[model samples]
Target: MALLVAGAFFMEILDATIITPAIPLIATSLGVEPVDVNVAITAYLVTVAVLIPATGWMTDRFGIRPVFIAAIAVFTLASLGCAFSVSLPMLVAMRILQGIGGAMMVPVGRLAVLRYSDKADRVRAIALLTWPALAAPVIAPALGGAIATVGSWRWIFLVNIPIGVVGFLLALKLIRGGPASAARPLDWRGMLALGGGIAAALIALESVRVTGTNWWQVATGTAVAVVLLVLAVVHLLRTPHPLITLSVLRFRSLRITVTAGSLYRMVITAVPFLLPLQFQLVFGWTPLRAGLMVAALFVGNLTIKPATTPLMRRFGIKRVLLVNGVLSVLWFALLAVLHPGLPIWLIAVILYVSGALRSIGFTAYNTLAFADVVGDDLTHGNTLNASVQELASGVGIAVAALLISQLTPLVGGGPGAAYSATFLVLAALLAVTLIETLRLPRNAGAEVSGTRIRRRDR
Candidate 1:
């Protein structure tokens, strides 16, 4: 179950990351500006963010087997659509379809692993489940770059067809879970509020990043999103059978990890989005060269995984998070100072360390998220965590786009300075999460980490 789900999960993430290095190529092919191609990235993620709230309910209502099968089919077909798209809008439309499939596929797939594994094996189960997250980014840049340079960029999307087919066949043969649990009444009000709020806010952020969007439109979108989100919070709190159980936030471990992890994700997620663009646009590197360079980040990600479990066992979650968070922030800050002429080895080393820190930090966050969650509430906890991850990643891209666009005009610097300013902004955002890490109790998540920490007064 873990292997099957992880394979499907890798397809989703690989689809997401592989497109990063190809964004510039696609923009030129589609006759759009480089900045405008970012919409393709944001569109898919925003669709996922908006619809992810409904995943738990959908899986419950539809049964996991059929739903998972359908998600794979949709994602596979949509990949074809993306490959054949001749225009930006067509590509964006295909991406939205792809997002809907991903929104259903990822959380439901994880839920299967959670249901199958024992608590004693959960750390290992989640590690196996999440390995794709590490592996996909590793392969995406080099593969995507190679395809874009040697052939048409369309092959990037087309490559998913075989993987999706294999996943579907294996799922049918090996996945033999029971019927879905009794269905919960759909939370229509919460769904509308949260979905609309998130969509509007993301669109507003994207609009601000564009060159000629009206200021009033941005203000109105922002205001509407804020109001709708506040109302969504109120409605969820008061209603029975809320779409997502925010009440789970009462768990200190879950709350801190979600709150802090969302910030960390928002900042770190921007790197993949911005890093490729900077390499191609600012450094004047070819897509293949840029991707090979970015592979250093991938190398770092892969190298750190085997060490994660032992590190948590030795240092405890709180200490590991603090140290990793600090190093991650420092490396991100380092990006702001890099120039086109830097030696390749130094750049590779920087990217490698940054990726290692990211891998450690994310592993710690994913493990600790479930530390305090118990039976029956496990579904809700998984749903909430998945939604936050998607939403934060979407906003991260939007935030990077907006920062670059706005700072470009204000700083009176070229594209390099614009990218550097954006990196600093993301670094500052990530640094804020360090404060949250500091506030954690010494023994936080000790139950899961298997490390003992003596209590100390804060």
Candidate 2:
């Protein structure tokens, strides 16, 4: 079941960025500027993020099995739509449909895993789920570059067809979820406000990142987003049945991941986004070459999987996060010093370590998040975590893009200088998470991790 969910997770995440390398080809084929086609990607991410708050409701109201299978079918059909798109509008529409499917698919699947799994086994279950996040982004660039180089960019979407079909069949055979007997009514006001706020904020951030978007529009969007988000929070706190139960956030273990852990996710996600562009624009490398270099991160993420659980169980979540956080900050700083003249092998080594650290850090937070969130709290906790992670994925790229744009001129140099500055700034921001980690109890998350015994024996 976990494998089935992970496969779905991989396909969903893979489709998100596979078109990245094909952006130029897609632009040429559709008769638009490359920058304009970026909407297709943003549309998918924003739609997914905005709708994720409703995952728990969907699963509860519709029953998880029917909803999950429908999501697969929708995603499969949407992939076909994306492949056949004739223009930018068509592609963006298709991407939005894909988002609708994904908004239901992965998180629902994860909810099933979390809901059914034994507490003692959550570490393994979450670790299984974490790999898609680790492997998909790295693979997408390299795979997309190869496909776009050899064939039509449409193949990127076409590739999802078979994967989705297989996943659909597996889901039918394996997934078992029934609707809650006493599901609460949806909080329409909270739903509208939260989803609207997320959409507005993402648009504002993306617009700010773009070179020529009007400041008045950006300001208005940001203001509206702030208003809606504030309203959403208030409604969630006071409403009979919020889309997501805000009370679930009172769990410190989960709250830490939602706040500091999310920041770390956003910051780390930017590395992949920035590295590919930096490689092409600065090092004058081919897309394929740059992508291949980034694969070193994948290698590291894969190789380090075995040790993550053991390390956390041995040293506990607080120490693991603290060490990983400190190292990740230094890793970003190391990336800040990268230059075209640096050896390729050295760069690969650096990225490899970065990926290793990334895997460990993410797996730690994900596992610990639900350690203390048992029973009914698991539903809202899972939904909230999934939503934040989705939002972080989109915002990370936007934030990276915005930072580069603002820093490029300030550096008074070139793309390389701007990139260096961006990495340093991100490192400084990442350092902030460590402060939060420092305040956590030494034995935090020890129960699910089995570190309590280790600490006692020592």
Candidate 3:
């Protein structure tokens, strides 16, 4: 069951990143600017951000098995739609559908695993579940580049068909239907407000890059987003049952975790997106070589996973988070100093270390966030965390794109300037996590094993 959940997660994460290396090819085939084609990427991310808040309500109304199966089916079919898309708009639409499926697949699948897994094994269950998410980015670029170079870019999406089919079957066989809980009325009003707010904000962010910084269109989008967000906040405050329970924020550990997690993902997620472009466009490496270079990140992430549990047990979550958070920022900052004459192998080595440290830092922060929550709140907390993760990833990419676009002119409009400035900005963004992480109580994970034991008793 853990393997199935992880497999589903891996499939989603792999698809999320695999398209990046092929972005240039996709742009060329569709006769669009490379930056313009970012819409396809942003569209999927935005859709996930907007739809994620609805996952808990969906599971409650439909039951986990049905929802999980539907999500996989939708994602599988959407991949086919993406592969066959003939126009940029069409591709964007399909990706949006893909995001809808992905948004549901992860949270609901994890929910199933949590509900079914013995309480004593919850920590290990979560650690195991995260493996695919950790591994997906590692493999995505290399696999994407390999597929794009030797075959058509369409193969990336087509490749999911078989995996999705196997996942669907495994899910059906291994996943059992639990006793159906009473369905609650869907929060239509809250959903509209939250979804609208996220959609408007994302559109505004994307508009900044799409219409350029000075365009009135960007201002209009920003205004609309602000209005929608204000209304969403008001709606949530007044609603009896909000789409996202406002009370989750009241938990101190959870609050700190959410803030730290958002900032952490914001800084780290940008690396894979930025590095591949840098290696290929700035360093003049082939897509395959760039992909291989990016693979160093995965290697680093994998290498560090073995030590994560022991590190948390030894130094404690807060200390480990604070130290690693600062180190990860430093690692990203180092990229800004890389010169054209630097050795490629050295660059890979630096990236590998960054990836390892980042994985360790994020894993610690994520696990600690839920260290204090119990029972039903655990499910709510996990769902909220997942939504925030998606939101952060979307914001991270949009911000990176905007920064790169702004820096392009200042850096002399070449790949070198674009990547250097982007890396500097990413490093700074990551540094902000140090502040959030400091808010964690000194003994935040003090009862770590107790929390595991408690989950088992439930």
TM-score of each: 0.92, 0.88, 0.90
User: What C-alpha lDDT does candidate 2 achieve relative to the native structure?
Assistant: 0.85
- Candidate 3 on 62-145: residue-level lDDT in tens? 788888988999999999999999989899999999999998998889889899889998999998897787678888989999
TM-score of 2: 0.88
Q: Tell me the alpha-carbon RMSD of every candidate.
A: 2.6, 3.5, 4.2
Please list the residue runs of candidate 3 whose C-alpha ends up more than 4 Å from where it truly belongs after superposition: 1-5, 113-130, 169-181, 209-214, 439-441, 449-458
Against the true structure, candidate 3 has what lDDT?
0.80
In each prediction, how many residue pairs overlap at the backbone (N, C-alpha, C within less than 3 A)? Answer: 0, 0, 2
Candidate 1: which stretches are off by over 4 Å? Answer: 1-4, 112-130, 169-181, 455-458
Score residue 116 of candidate 1 by CA lDDT. 71
Clashing pairs in 3: 119-455, 119-456
Instruction: TM-score for candidate 3, please give it.
Output: 0.90
* Model 3: residue 93 alpha-carbon error in angstroms: 1.1
- Can you write out model 1's per-residue Cα lDDT over 73-158, one digit (the tens) per residue? 99999999999999998999999999989988887888788877899988998988877877788888988888998998999999
Q: How far does residue 13 in candidate 2 sit from its true spot (Å)?
A: 2.3
